[model samples]
Target: MRWWLTAAVFWTLLIMAVCWLPMPMFPIGTGGEHPKRFPHLDKAVHAGIFVVFGLLWLRVIPGPRRFLVVVAAGAALAAITECGQNLPIIGRDGELADGLFDVLGVFLAYPLATFLFRRVRDKQPVVSMTRA
Candidate 1:
């Protein structure tokens, strides 16, 4: 796999880890000090993270199968990570809204990735001494 692909996978895993961090140790107890419920911020963070990973995956996939592969990968990863929250170690809440946000993140990432890849590919190659 290309370096970018590796980076993308690494980033996806990293984000999953971060998302699961504040769950078990910081469980929202029944009190006045509940965790801040900023749904919009949560959505934005999810969308932004996946958008970057999606673009990078799209870059690495190459050829016509790029978009489909990237999107499917994003969705699969999202599902796996969400389900993994049920594990004893992580103990994160598995909410449908979170999964929905994950899907949206992948969906929003695809087009931007495609456009960036296309733009870069369209650029003219620079002649160098090694090519002569």
Candidate 2:
């Protein structure tokens, strides 16, 4: 539990840093200098990052309401990141599609994480303590 919480905090900060960083810091080919080999690659990256982000939060947050809270928080963070990108000083453009991809990533992560958790749980051996 402690490890999961620490991971969640670390990952969240990493995401925030990536979103707030300057455009030039990104890979050279990611921009208009050359035709993008994979035009939608950025969206895919956003989705992938949010998927991990949501899963990390889910691991730390307990209760039946965990899914709802995590998804909402992920979406809010996505929106805020997109808005931040629009700041003139940042010189980054905000796109609705990016936010949509972020939300989709979080939503998709729930089922994937649930499946993995169940698989691992089922494979674990039961242990019993006894006095000989």
Q: Which residues of candidate 1, in runs, are more than 4 Å off?
A: 22-39, 122-132
Model 1 local distance difference test score: 0.71
Per-candidate clash tally: 0, 0
Query: After superposition, which runs of candidate 2 have C-alpha atoms over 4 Å from their true positions?
Result: 29-36, 129-132
lDDT against the true structure, per candidate, is 0.71, 0.88
Give the CA lDDT, 0 to 100, for residue 99 in model 1. Answer: 71
- Candidate 2 backbone collisions, by pair: none
Candidate 1 lDDT over 17-109, as tens digits, reads: 766664636544322142477535655666778778777777677788777877788888777777877777776666566677877887887
Model 2 clash count equals 0
